[model samples]
Target: MPGIYLGAILFSLVGMMLIDLKYSLALRVAPVRTTLTVLISTSFFLAWDLVGIATGVFVKGDSPLFVGVTLAPHLPLEEVFFLLFLSYLAVVMVAVFERRAAARRRHGGGRSATHRAPLEESA
Candidate 1:
């Protein structure tokens, strides 16, 4: 009830983090890349949200989960957290696909540099 919105967001964030841990899709693949991806994506969208708020396109909605704090008019404190979750979600999505693709490639085997089977030296 009162905790529904914020609880859902926190749960999803934790779930994604756990998936990242189990697969090592983020830190193992590229820690810097994942960090930058999340940071840059979050910044871009936050800026977009700020613009929307300034332009009156965005408005804070009544929510039991929001702390009722805001950096600006119609911008709730929860929005920042939500944006971070969104960014993490995007990066995790890329990491998942990358993992699957690499697995597929490995299982499918690799071709030689010229796209042919590797030549074996004379036995």
Candidate 2:
């Protein structure tokens, strides 16, 4: 159970990547942009975590699921992987929404049948 959490995270990351690849979203669409976005976001979150740790707001609790590794005093090695997954998830989600919106626009200004006005009855 020590590495279960890490395994789960990595599994989920792989699934997300498969989805992105299948749909040519995010990473498949723009590798450099997606990488940069994830890196920036991960870096920002890491900084936030550091600040929280400094302020005593963030603390690492003992867990059997952890890999027993720490990057810093309160930061775990798995934290980086989790942060990367989170950032990548965000990027993939945005790409999905953008693709859907673009498809909607191409089809007709993004108005679905539900949004269309009802047709008039014949005389």
Candidate 3:
């Protein structure tokens, strides 16, 4: 239904925004780098999707549940947006995990520093 498609779009946008905020605030990523990474990843996914559609690996069916113009069998412009949203979400999840791991390493290293005595004894 149109309602479902609309809801999907809204949810995707919100999710992407949250992910962006998390990366920006927690990872301290620059806006330019974030934007570039997302842009590049999205482009790659889109190209892959397009190829899949062309090769019949992915086919669209007649469904009123989708938004945008359908150029081929079940293929709609809106699918690109959906893919990009999902891809960005995946990247954000990876970034969050990496950030957590790095934090843990730093914290553990700091604690270990106190346990190890100084190499050079006081004269």
Top-scoring candidate (TM-score): 2
RMSD of each: 7.4, 3.6, 7.3
Task: Write the number of the candidate with greater lDDT, choosing between 2 and 3.
Answer: 2
For each candidate, what is the lDDT?
0.80, 0.92, 0.69
Ranked by lDDT from best down, the candidates are 2, 1, 3
TM-score, every prediction: 0.77, 0.88, 0.70
Q: In model 1, what is the error at residue 44, expressed in angstroms?
A: 0.8
Off by over 4 Å in 3: 22-28, 71-74, 109-123
Show the lowest summed lDDT stretch of 10 residues, model 3.
114-123
Candidate 2's TM-score reads 0.88
Off by over 4 Å in 1: 1-4, 109-123
Regions of candidate 2 where Cα sits further than 4 Å from its true position: 110-123
Q: Tens-digit lDDT track for model 1 on 2-108?
A: 65666678888899888888888785678888889888988898899989988989988887667667788887767777888999988888878877789779877
Which residue pairs clash within candidate 3? 60-74
What's the count of clashing pairs in each model shown? 0, 0, 1
- Per-residue CA lDDT of model 2 for 1-123, tens digit only, reads 899899999999999999999999988779999999999999999999999999999999999999999999999988999999999999999998998899888899866656665562232
Candidate 2 least-lDDT 10 residues: 114-123
Among the numbered candidates, top lDDT falls to 2
